[model samples]
Target chain A: MITSPKVETKNLNLYYTENQVLHDVNITIAEKKVTALIGPSGCGKSTLLRCFNRLNELIVGTRIEGEILLDGKNIYQNGMDVVDIRRRVGLIFQKPNPFPKSIYDNIAFGLKIGGMKNKSRISEIAEKSLIDTGLWEEVKDRLHTSALDLSGGQQQRLCIARALAIEPEVILMDEPTSALDPAATFKIEELVTQLKNSYTIIIVTHNMQQAGRVSDFTGFLYLGKLIEFGNTNILFTRPKEKLTENYISGRFG
Target chain B: MNIRNITDKFFHYFFLVSGVSAIGILFAIFVMLAMNGLQTFTDVSISQFFLSTRWNPSAFGEPSYGILSLVVSSIMVTLGAMVIAVPLGIGTAAYLSEIAPPFLRETLKPVVEILAGIPSVVVGFFGIVFLGPLIADVFNLTSGLNALNGSILLAIMALPTIVSVSEDAIRSVPKDFKEASYALGVNRWLTLVKITLPAASSGIVAAVMLGIGRAIGETMTVLMATGNALQMPGSFFDSVRTMTANIAIELGEVPFGTTHYFGLFAVGLVLFFMSLAVNLTAEHFTKKYRRYRT
Candidate 1:
């Protein structure tokens, strides 16, 4: 099936102070589909992911010189509402970073911040978000307990639920399972595949098999450049770039 | 054991005694206070000692020794100081941790520490000369020295503790939490107020409790500034005395082996327990709310 590009970067170059971190690069991410970015450490995968929501601005002296468009609108244009951009495009961190609040509050925080005041509607969305992330039954009874009490996998899922509760059109995950064990990683990988039917998912991962298993479209980045991009199955099996082949075969990261 | 082990053993025993001696000194203080203070209850009925509002020990007639007024003065002054300090201190802390640029935060931090390090007597002097005159001039009171003066001085004294500790608490909240809030599309101000502040609430509460402890135990400033009136305090403008101020003022001139002398010790005993209770409550909050701090 063909999918329209939800987000696309045009000759994106990012600099941290004097050091150029992301070279002139361009890539298209599909809507309502799981797009995985795989590369070794320091390859600018996470940096590119952060560009989608302008989270890179949090770091001082970081500069972006190119346009990152969401639904064909330049997000980096002057006077663009960053908070609104981030609301439309949410993100999940590598380690599960839930608030110290209870499970219910963790999910309700975004809705309340977005000015949703109807109590019953907030609860309904909170319950639905939990169900979407597959954590409802396990956490339903303990909704008021601290989110920190959940296990690592459960905490990561709660982060996803929290993002979903805000109803963002795009969801970005930065190595969302890097801190989890194998079983937990499997659950998250499965959840990522299942979540693509509704939200445009962009996942940055270092694991080759995870990228192959979960993503419908795969982009291999190397040395701050996109080395290859294609269907995940075709990219895994067929050779288009020597660097992609070399990195994929476990010769070196 | 080798020579190294022998040296380690020696240091271990030495440190053990060193640590134990701190508690020993505390026990000695409690024992001394109890020895001197228990004698007062024999003549000063518990009701008369703690209940009555009058506190005249040297009356030509039957001396009335009620500490209720002093207690109220201390609490009211300290609470008023807290009213002034908590918002300002926490605001400064939040600015340092979340908003202020690096140079501003660095410059302000040492200023707060210096504020704390200034001698309480020096603060008392300022209270009497500057703050007292300002309060009287602004409010049109007869005398500047009052609970308001005491509170202003105590608030200055308490600001350093509150700002220092709450700043630490706010700073220690993981950057990840702030980032997470930003990811949810909340503005920076809302994130700091709703998420960052609440996440650091445990440490902030502990900081506020410790400020209360500091304000309650402070003696010199209140003694020199609060006019040391003996009657029940009616308003913030009314001259009054705290238990610490009372003990400090009378303990020096009281004749030896007198009930009045022992009465001062009783006041000291009560002040010590109040400070102890405030500190313990601070510690309790720190421990109880630290579970989610990870």
Candidate 2:
């Protein structure tokens, strides 16, 4: 299938102090499609996902040498607004990290901090996002209660609703299901499939079956190198690299 | 049925005895203070002791025994100390916990602990020699010793507690919360103000209440620096005497069984209750903070 790239990284290399974490690599994320990065631990898949929005730049000893482009413009270029880049590209973490606040405030915090002040409009956006994530019915009655009170699945969905409220062009998920149970993981995976119709999503996962089930494109990484990249269906059944096949076939992580 | 069971029971009773003894000692102290302090009311009327502003127990003609002024003075100095300490302490804590490198934090934390260990009398002397004169010069007052001077000294004494406790609270706010806020396009400053600080607010409040308790209970510094004036303080700059200072000043010289000595014990009782109230607030907030954590 042919598609335009929403985000691209070229000759990207990242180092933490003296240790290299991601080698020179290039990849394109298709517009409005879910791309899954699958690898074992320490493979730099999460690092790559963070790079799309420059989240890695905050770490103390990290250094990136290469161009990451959002909409064909180098995000690494001089005079880029990091806050603007982050606003456009939202991220969710492995753990469900709702602020110790109400469910309504969880969704409204992003908008309010971004300078949205109109009360009715903020409520409208909050309700719309919650409905979009299929959490409105479950949480609507208790929007004023602490978000930390939600179950793992509901909390993860609340986080998704939180991201949606901000209206980002792309969303990044860093092992978002790793901390959740199987049922919660299924809910998140299904949400990912549904989300791709509107926003470009880049997900990092260690579970091969999860990548196959949810993603249109899959990139298999091994030991800081992108060993295989292509359609998810082909990558799962017909991987060209031996390491990718070995990892996917359960021989070794 | 076995020696193991006997050992377990022995230790359990031992710890139970230890715990019960602590409460027993506290209760005994309260009873003793109440018994001695209540005796003063027999000689001096309760309304005069509590409501009057004059406190000259050694007046030549008619000795007065009011404590309202002393209470007001203590409150003034404590409030003034808190005004200076809370912001500075919380800011230093935030910097240490959120921004300071590991090496600096490690070095500075021990330094703060040492600051707490400095003898209060020595700190009080420093207040007399340095801070009191500086304040008098700055504010163009006749005397160097004042409530502001005592407040400054007490704020220095309270910094270690406030800084360490607030730092622990801020640091305990999960890193995940900060990361989530940052991912939503908020910067570190905004995240700290909005999410991190609010999340840690109960703990920070507990720290502040503990600091207030420390300032109110402090005797030597206020005794030396606050000029020990008997009048009710009108502002932070006024010379004043705290209840702790009053008790310390009069107790050593007063006759053991006289109304003056018993009156001092009554003041001690009031001071105890004041600190108890502050400490109970701190404990309550600490419990509330723990609830948020889990």
Candidate 3:
């Protein structure tokens, strides 16, 4: 017996006002795997990631045509709560966006929204999630401190911990490490590899080497089209498309 | 010296002179008021002026000239106006900056601001002619002009100041903060209450302070609608007088060398001090918020 894909997109098309941003696309994301979407700037990688959680709904005049399935259920169907969908499929933004609140409160926000009223249980879960992201030891003594005071790398990890506290099945990261230094980026890459054991992960990144290091599967997008996709090792070693070859080889963006 | 050095020194002196000149004018006005009014403190006991109620400076033998009742009346009217102005003004501001659609916002913002540009004398006339009669009819009172009517008119006059300032404060909050809250799956109302309002609280408080200062100093509206009565007001329906109103009313009657004249000056001095304190407090809080936000 085979399990269904964790997430699948069927003939997805997107437009911003009159300008089309994403062409007809079809892809399937497996469970408990790390998939990276690599492309140049303005190539619709981030746009495609945003489609999974409906972040693009905030923009006026943006239209999407097609269907997205998560766990064999259509996400855009009537009576499906966007908030509930977002809670199940969490997103970590590129910039670290910790609330101007206490570090503890930042992690507990989603749990509170999900109606977890027991204080002790919330504290336990917050601690567990923070430790899972390797930030508990550094911030345990000062969990009440303002999140803005944390270092850039710590803030990014805290955001990941925040997303984890919601107990999402699939985590979507939009270039989560592009804003960080090399050391911080390496740490985040390691965390992503470790997280793939239990959670299906999708990431949009511009770094070819980082993608090769962390991702098991990679999809190359250019001009809103998926040019090529395959195992990370195979794609880097032998890309079928010339555009993918040129992009991975640094000939042009 | 070099040309660049000379130009820089010239510019620095120009800025210094401009700033000093502004403060210097304020100091001059305060010193003048004090010099003209301080004699009242010496001639009559300051305690007598503050504690007594009788305000008949031209009475038969006693020559009573107490202003305590007027001061009390002024506080009462200003407080009443603030009770009506602060909430309505701030609510209008929130509606304009946060909730109103773009087309409605553009229309309502200017309409609210136009309330400020109307001359105070026109507001005074409208209060006496229209609002005073309507208030008197509603309450079935003997006189139309009263403290309640005055407060209502002043409240309308203060609305524009509060709305404009508070709207600016709300608009100044960073967009990223709102986006972060939305991404957390928080609803619009909760995000506004928990994030946007708290972040802009210092500015809102400053707006309230500025509104209070304007209400306290307003003269023509209070003078016309309040019946210029120098007795302590017992209720919202009773006629009363305020510090600015009393000064404006009595300035023509009091002789330049007399105690009554100096007492009016003293009232002006008190108004100046009150507004100065309020402005300074608002400035302090605004600076504190800036430090944290930056």
Candidate 4:
């Protein structure tokens, strides 16, 4: 089955002041699938993920050329509200970044700011979001406690639930498990696979095994260019490009 | 011993002596205040000294050692200064940390620092010459020197300390928390009030307490600007005398060791405890905030 792209980029280019970071890249991210971007340090994979939500523009003197479309609408067009576009897309950072607030309020922050006013309804959505991320049972008894008191793994999951509470259509994870232990990393990978069934998932990772384990499609980025992109199994086993094969085979990163 | 080793040992003991002498001076001052004030404490019951509102220590017939009015004026002036300084300080800090462009922040920060560098006597002089008359004219008062003038001057003096320390606290809030708030699509103002301010709450609290300390212990400005009235202040517009001003006014040329002289020492002791309490509270809050910073 051929699925239409949920997000598409056309000849996308990015620059920080005078320095170019991404160049002439075209890619399509399909709906309801996990697409992983793999690259070395400063390879621009994280920068590309930030582009989806226009987060890159936060830095002073950042300039973007070409179009990034979400569901066939140009996100960068004049008159398109940046805040509204950001609400439709959620982002999870490399480290667990829960607010210095109670566990329940952490999830409810998005709901409240997004204008969901009913008290009971906000709690209802917060509870559901926690359950969806498999954190409801562990945290149910102490939802009023500070979120920082949670274990590192639990904090990361709480962050995921925080993103999910807004019910965004697309979720972006940028090395979400890089700070967790092996066991915690495995649990997050499991959650990402489960999350793929409902929301379009785009992840940027440095761990090859994580990309292979959780992703359906993979793109290997090198020096700000997409070297190869294809089915995950084929990309790992029989890469089409020399750089992709070298990277997957543990050659120079 | 070799010259280097001898020099190192000499320097180490020199530093140790200097540190010990500084602490010894503080202990000596405390002992002096207690010894000198002890006579006054016995002459007038402690309750009478603290509770009596009429503070006439040099009356021809009978002297009254009441300091309740001084305490009340000190508190009123400190609270009034906090009312003016706290919001202005924190608002300027937030603007410097989050809103202002780099060039403007750089330009304005040093201006606040210079305000702090101006001597308290000079500030008191400014109050006497400018702020006092202006306030008197505006309120149609008999004289310009009053609690209101004192508070306005002290607020200006406290601003630099409060704004600089608070700016550091707000800026020290981790980048990740801000990014997370922005990722949630929350606006800049909401994120500032809800996330950054709460995270920096303890530091901001410590800053305010320290500012209060500066306002309460300040002697020159309050003494010059408050008209040194011994009567209890009926309102902010009325001329008032704070504890600092009382000690300052009586410390000079009162016959040494007379009950009146000892009474001033007792007031000095009270001032000491007040500043000590403020410093201790500030330290407690700063330590509490330090734990979460990591």
The TM-score obtained for chain B by all candidates, in the order given, is 0.95, 0.94, 0.90, 0.97
Which candidate number has the best lDDT? 1
Candidate 1 root-mean-square deviation in Å: 1.6
Model 2 B-chain TM: 0.94
TM-scores, all models, native as reference: 0.97, 0.95, 0.89, 0.98
All DockQ scores:
0.88, 0.79, 0.43, 0.81
Q: After superposition, how far is residue B146 of candidate 4 from its true place, in Å?
A: 1.3
Give the true-structure RMSD of model 2.
Answer: 2.3
Candidate 2 local lDDT, B1-294, one digit each (tens): 899999999999999999999999999999999999889899899999999999999988788889999998999899889999999999999999999998999999889878989899999999999998898899898888999999999999999999999999999999889988989999889999999999999999999999999999999999999999889888777889999999999998998898888999999888888999999999999999888777
Q: Classify candidate 4 by CAPRI docking class.
A: high
Give lDDT tens digits, candidate 1, residues A1-253: 4468899999999999999989888889989999999988999999999999999999989999989999999999999999999999999999999998999999999999899999999999999999988999899999999998999999999999999999999999999999999999999999998889999999999998999899998999998998898888988899599988999998889
Which pairs of residues have clashing backbones in candidate 4?
none
Number of colliding residue pairs in model 2: 0
- CA RMSD of all predictions: 1.6, 2.3, 3.2, 1.3
Query: What stretches of model 3 exceed 4 Å from their correct place?
Result: A1-4, B1-20, B46-72, B289-294
Candidate with maximal TM-score:
4
- Alpha-carbon shift of residue B170 in model 2 (angstroms): 0.7
Give the DockQ-based CAPRI class for model 2. Answer: medium
Tens-place lDDT digits, model 2, residues A192-234 = 9999999999999998889999999999888788998999999
By DockQ: ranked, best first:
1, 4, 2, 3
Q: Write the per-residue lDDT of candidate 1 for residues B1-294, one digit (tens) a residue.
A: 899999999999999999999999989989999999989998899989899998999998799888999999999999999999999999999999889888999999989988999999999999989999999999999899999999988998999999999998899888999999999999999999999999889899999999999999999999999999987889999998999999988998999988899999998888888998999989987886566455
- Tens digits of per-residue lDDT for model 3, A126-155: 999999999999999999999989999999
B94 Cα displacement, candidate 1 (Å): 0.1
